[model samples]
Target: MPRRDRPRRAAFAHLGPLDTPIPISTGTAALTLETDGSVLLDVNGVPSSHLHPDPEHLVFEYMRWMLLVIDRHLAELPGPDASGAASSPPAPAPHLAHLGGGGCSLPRAIAARHPRSRQIVVEIDELLAHQVREWFDLPRSPQLRLRVEDALGALTSWREKRFDVLVRDVFSGAVTPPELTTAETAAHADRVLRDGGIYLANCAAPPGSGLMADEVATLSTVFPHVGVIAEPAHLSGKRRGNCILLASRRPLPEGIDRDLRSDAVSVRLARRPQVEALARAGRVLHSR
Candidate 1:
C-alpha cells in the first residue's frame, strides 16, 4: 500500500458522555470523558486521553505539568509597569499564533498570564474547539481569536502576518502532517515569525527512535538556535519520549532556569537525570 494513501487509525477512543467529575489529585475534580474503550480527563482545559490497552495513570498529570511549564515561562514576561505606563515591558504585548487549538489549553493559559497579549488559535477540529468552550470556563478576553481550518492551510493563506510566538502542537497518533514538519514548512514558520520570534512545538517520539533526531535536524536547518526539554531516559533511549522543542532566530530569555524552576511541575522535573541529559544532548545537536 502506498504510504500516502494509507488509512489513518482513530487517534481517540470514543468515550460516552461525561458528567461525573474525576479526581486528579486530593481535591481537584477533573472533567472525565469515557469512550467505549478509553477514558480521558480534562485537566486545565487539556484533554488527557488514554486507551484501555495503555492505562498510563500519569497522562493528565503530565499534561498539567506541561501547561504549568508554559505558564511559568509566560509569567516571566515583564508585566505592566507603574507610573501609569501605557504599555508593558515587552511592548505591544506579544502577538501569538497557536497552530493547534486543543481545547484552547495553551491559549487560555497565555491569556490569563499575559493579559495584554493577542492570540490567534487555529484548530482543524471545529467540533473539538466548540466542545472546549462548552466544557471549560475560558476567559472571554478580546486577545483570543479562534479559527476553524487546517493549521498549515491557514498559515499558508495568512502569509502577510507575523507573530512573536508560534506554537505548533497538531498531532494524530504517530503521524503528523508531513507538510507541517518539513524544511519548507519551517521556512513558512520563519516568514510568519517576527525578528527574534520564538517557535515552540510538542514533538512526539519513541525511545531509541530517530524521529526526534530527524525533527531537530530539520528545525536546525531553518532556525538559528533550537533547544529541547524532555525526560532524560528518552534521550538516552531508555524510554519512550515526549517533549517540547523551542526554536528561535534570537537568543532565549536570560532567566530560563529561574523561570522553569518557579513552577512546581517544572521544579519537580528540572533536576531529573533524564531532563538534564536531554537538555545537554539537545544543545549538542542544535549547535552549528
Candidate 2:
C-alpha cells in the first residue's frame, strides 16, 4: 500500500496543553505528553485513537471488534462456586498483565467484568500512563497498578509478578517493537504466566504480508499452543489486513464459539475460518 493511501485517522484527543511532543513517524503522527501526564497521539488532527474516551476508547473498528471476542472469552468460563459443587470453576481471582496500555480500554473492560481480577498496565511513555489515569476513570482499586516504562523493560523487572493472562498491544505507526516479537520475548512472557495462562497480541499484517507468518514462527518458539483471530478481510486472503493472535500454554477454553456469538462486538470472531485453522494447527514449541 502506498504511504499516502494508508488510512490516517485521528487516534487521540487533546484534553490539555501539550507538554513534550515526540515525532512518531517521519511527520505523520506526533505524540504529545500532556501536562496531566496523559499521552495523546494526534494523527493529522484526528483524536479517535484515544482508548479511554467516554463513548468509546479505541477508534479502530477492528480493535473494538477484537475486544468483544476477548470479553466473550472471559465471560464463557464458569463462575466460581461458593458451595461444594461437582465442577468448581477456576480461581475466582485472576492475575492479568497488559504489556501495552493504550488508553486502558482492555484493562478497563476486564476490571468491569472480572471485578476480582488484579490488573497491571505497563506503558512505555510516562506521559501516556499519566494521561490514562487523569483522562479516564480507570478503576482505583488496589487490584490495578499502572507502570511507566518500556513494555519489555517492565516485563524483565517483574520478578515476582505472574499473570493468568498477558496481552501485548504495543504498536507505533504500523510497526510493532521488534524486540517484543522475538522468541526470547515469548520465553520471558511464558515465565511470567501461570501454568494455564493465555497470551494474546494485536498484530498488524497487510494482505499477503509476511507479518503473520513471521509472528507465528516467533511465538511458536516459547508457547506450547499458538492461535490467531484475524479479521474477515485477512482470512479471505484478500489485501486488507491486521488481526489478533492468541497463544496459550494450555488448550483454549471450551465453548469459545458460543461465547463469541453471544454479543455484537464478539460476532466478528466467527467470521473467519482461517483463524480457527491456525489455532488448531498450532504446534508445541520447546521452551528454553
Candidate 3:
C-alpha cells in the first residue's frame, strides 16, 4: 500500500494545495493531513474524525475508552506487522454496528486490530459516506460495510440481535440528532444488540448540563447497567467536554472493568455518587 495520498495541512493559516472542502448536500467537510501523517475529517467546521495512517492507533480520548470497553471481552490480539502486512485476530471476532459514519475511524481501528470483526456503519448523508469511504479506503463486507440511512430508521429496522456492540456516535453539527435521544430509540438499539452486548454513545456537553445524564436515564430504561467515563473535571461539573455514556444489559462488575486502569484519566468510571447527581439533572427535567 502506498502510504497517504492526501495533501498535508500546512502551517495554521496556509493550507496545502490539496486541502479542499468535500461538497455534501447540507454541510461542508474536508480532510486535512497532519504533520505526522494522520488525517482529520472536518465537517461543518467541527472536528469529526482524527485518523492515523496506521489504523491500529487510536488518537482521541473518547475513542480510546470506547475501544477499551470492547477489548474487555476478547482475547489479546497480535500487534501490527513491522513489514506492514496484515495479521488477523483469533476466532470470535467482534460484531459491531456503528450508528455514525464520520471518518469511520473507530471501525478502521477495529478492523486492523481485529481483522475478522464484522462492522456496519450507518450514516445519513449519502455523499459524506461516499467521500469518507473513498478517502479512508475502508474495508469491504464480511469485515465492514456501510449502511447509508438515518441511524434511527436503521436501528428500528434491524430484525435480529446480532451486534456485540452498538455505537451511537452520530452527530449533526456538534449535537446528536434528536431522534436518537428518545426512549423508543434506545429500546430499538437495545433490541439490535445480542445478549451481554454494550451500547456506547459520545455525549459532548458543558459541565452541570444534563446531556450526558439524559443519556444515562434513557439507556437505563433498556439497559440494566449504565455508567459514564469522563475526565474528573467533567464528572464533577467543573468543565465542558465529551463523556462516553456506556450502557449494558450485563452487570458492570462482570469483567467490564478489566480495562479500567487508573493511570488513564478517562479510563476511570465516574463514581456512583457522581453519576446519581448527573442523572438527577436529567430526571428532574424529564419529570417536569
Candidate 4:
C-alpha cells in the first residue's frame, strides 16, 4: 500500500500551515505545528498531545509508556517481519476506544503502526476536537472516529466486550475529574471490555499524593490485574507528572520492562504488588 494512502502524518506542517487558536468551553487551546513536523495541541498552557506520524516521536513520557504497553501486546500476535519472512499468523486487528481525544496522538500512532485497527475517540471539548481533526488531517470514519461526548456517557452506551482496549485520558484543568476516577467508572470500563482486555489510563497526581493509590484501588475492584508505569522520578516523589496505569482481567504481558527500555524517555513499571501497596494507603473513591 502507498504510504500516502495510509493514515500517516506528514513530515511537514499540513494541518494549520501555522499555529492557530481554537476556543474551548473553559477557554482556548493553541494548535501549532513545528518546523520539524511535530503537532502540539495545548490546552490552557499545558500540552495535551505532541504528535508526529512516527510512533517514536512521542514527546510525553506517559504517552511513551502507554504506547509501550500497546506495542508489546501487539507484538505477541503472529505476523511476518519487515523482511517478509513467514512468521506466526497475524492476530486480528484490535478494536480500541479512547476516553479523551486530546490531540489524538496515541490514536494516530496506533493507526500508523496497526493500520488494521478501528478506533473511536470521545472528546468533551468540541472545539478542541474540531481543531485537532482539521489541523491533523485525521482519517475519516471507519478507520478513525471522533465523538463529542462525555467519556462516561460514551462508555455507558458501548456494547459489552466490544473493544480489546480502553484508554482513559480525560482531564479537567490539570487534575483528572474525580467522577471519572471512581470505582463506578472502573466498572463501566470493565463492562465494555472483553475478558483479559487491557484498560489504560493517564493519571496525574502530586508527589506522595494519595490520588494515585485511590485510582489503583478503584481499578483493582474491577480488574484482576493492575499496574502502573512512569518515570522513576515521578514514582519516587521527586517530581509531578502523569503515571500510566494498566488493568486487565488476566495476567499482563511479560518483558514490559524490556520493551520500555527502548523508549525515548526512561520508564519504570510498578506491577500489581507495588500498586496495591499504594492503594492500601488510600481510600477507594466512589461516584459522587
Point to the candidate with the largest TM-score.
4
Best by lDDT: 4
lDDT for each of the candidates? 0.59, 0.63, 0.75, 0.80
Model 3 TM-score is 0.82
Candidate 2 C-alpha lDDT tens digits along 1-288: 443564443434444445334343223334465443335555434332444332233445555645554565566544577686878655557778888775676777667556787889887666656665655556775677898788989887775337777888887656677778777788888888877777888887776656676677677666766666554557545755556777777776555556445434433443334544443444433324
Q: For each predicted model, how many residue pairs clash, with residues at least 3 apart or on different chains?
A: 6, 9, 0, 1
List RMSD in Å for every model shown: 12.3, 8.7, 6.6, 4.4
Q: How would the candidate models be sorted by lDDT, starting from the highest?
A: 4, 3, 2, 1
Better of 1 and 4 by TM-score: 4
Residues 1-288, candidate 1, lDDT per residue (tens digit)? 443564443333333256555333222224454454333544334443332212121233334344454454445545556566656443467678888765565576567556788888887766555555555544564588888889889887766437877888776534556668777777788889877777887777777656666677677777877766655565556776566666778765555555455434432333334433443354222212
- Model 4 Cα lDDT, one tens digit per residue, 1-288: 544565654563446535656667658787677666677778887778887756455777777788779877666544545565466555566789999988888888788678888899999988778777776777777878999998889988998998888999988878888888888889889889876788999999898787777788888888888888878787766888889889988788888888878777778787557787877876888976
Name the lDDT value of residue 261 in candidate 3: 68
Cα TM-score of candidate 4: 0.87
Off by over 4 Å in 2: 1-81, 84-92, 261-288
lDDT (Cα, 0-100) at 11 in candidate 4? 65
Clashes of 4: 1
lDDT of 1 at 97: 86
Q: Which stretches of candidate 1 lie over 4 Å from their true place?
A: 1-16, 19-81, 85-90, 261-288
